[model samples]
Target: MPEPPPTADVSTALVTGGSAGLGQVIAATFADAGYRVVLVGRSSERLDAAKQQLDTQPGRDIVTLAGDVGVREDCDRIASTIEDQFGRLDVLVNCVGTSDRGLAGELTADRLHELIDQNVVTTLLCCQAFAPLLESSRGSIVNIGSLAGKVGARYLGGYNAAKHALAGLTQQLRLEWRDKGIHVALVSPGPIRRDDAGTRYRDRTDATLPASASAPGGGTKVKGLPAATVARAVLACAQKRRTDVILPGYLRLLIVLGNAFPRLGDWLLLKFTS
Candidate 1:
């Protein structure tokens, strides 16, 4: 039988794609919780700006790294840097992902590949590179997912596929790393309320898609969750070592119901979205 995990309190956390958007909010959430936070992203300027924004709290240690985590070399370099600087990592939150809008048939191979790189590859590379450190600390990893990952919704293009792949990867890593004492979890949430929630995907949609298709959750009737709410769930998942969490928690029942009765599931999904 495998031994139980250590009870040491986690101190340091690293969030990938942490320079802006939901990533920055998650970083702030960790910092607010008194964890020494490290934010990684592709743009040095954006990293610097994020650090400034997050450095407001007294005694909050915010470290920013500029690198593309999708690249293995960059992931290796970041891991090495973290080891040399912090010496331990108790939590890793993969908050990097991109959404798309279009019909499944219209989603070209190249576009699908791009979405995969943005959503799946980046998380995989970061998790692979950081596993050693997390192993030493018996840390937790929370991979941010979307509602699209749990159930298919129309007009999301490659997002649903990419997020579904991420959902599978999260579960696989949790099982594979169980003996290694790493807790991997997926926090699949509905469309988050953001400044650009209603129109972020406008440029990605075309005449074939409804204007509402550019809205959050592709015009799904579900309300947008606050960024802070999702961040809190990520924190809870790590601190509690949860297996899987679906936001708007009630959705879990729907997902299960859908799995059990495919026809009813299809009906519920179609009814939920415009």
Candidate 2:
């Protein structure tokens, strides 16, 4: 692989949820581009697998940390480990999140809390833990959001609430830290086509919607975008210091329409989505 541009001085990126899905691709892309990358995940096995894959980028530095970012103690350890190993962090990618599709009434309190802890709390804790290092480096943060964050969809109440909270936090941080020389941006993508059957959630529960509503190429027939697409968009966002990026471009229209016509948006979403 070719070396990164001479002008690129930023190094060291920490990506949560890097063991799989879009997070894995993002870590690989950064490593290939010569960034010292750290992959954080809950599963040691998956982290090891991801590290092995990124290690193929000759001469690139890769570290795998197995811990849950949703837990404060784990986040502290992760921050300390990065600071001790790298001395400074140039980028922080908050890619730790999960998705679920079920009617609000069907979701138990425990399930709702799980979604919040997995999605919203994980992002918040990581950001809080790493903010000091990023501020010192005058670095950037790229948060992975979702289209559900911008506009609610059928049978995704808990996920939508959590992602929307994440989106709000991203914007608030962007403004709050602007003067501190920390650039914060959000990358919100629609359904992402994972290598594993393009399923949204890692597991299917009894409360989940029918497979037709949850699987890619099922109801709406909208084939999800490749993971690499979002990874590249993240690179661009980091390089240009963009404020927000909604993937596939056209989804931006949905956000606008949803806000401008709430009733119409609800009708459209119901009519089109399974």
* Candidate that would win on TM-score: 1
lDDT of each candidate versus the true structure: 0.92, 0.82
> Residue by residue across 1-274, what tens digits does model 1's lDDT show?
9934422253889999899888889999999998989899989999999999888877677888889998999999999988887688999999999998999988899999999999999999999999999999999999999989999999999999999999999999999999999999999999899888877988878877878999999999999999999999999999999989998999999999998999999999999999
Which regions of candidate 2 fall more than 4 Å away from where they truly are? Answer: 1-10, 198-210, 217-221
Candidate 1: list runs displaced more than 4 Å: 1-10
lDDT by residue for model 2 (1-274), tens: 9955333244889999888878989988888777888899999999998888878868767889889888899999989987876688889999988787667777789988998888888888988899999999999999999878877776664888888888999999999999989999999887777666635442663434566655642334345789999999998898789998997788688768878999988876766577
Using lDDT as the measure, the top candidate is 1
Q: RMSD in angstroms, candidate 1?
A: 5.7
What are the candidates' C-alpha RMSDs? 5.7, 4.0
TM-score per candidate, in order? 0.95, 0.89
Count clashing residue pairs in model 1. Answer: 0
- Model 1, 145: alpha-carbon shift in Å? 0.6
TM-score of 1: 0.95
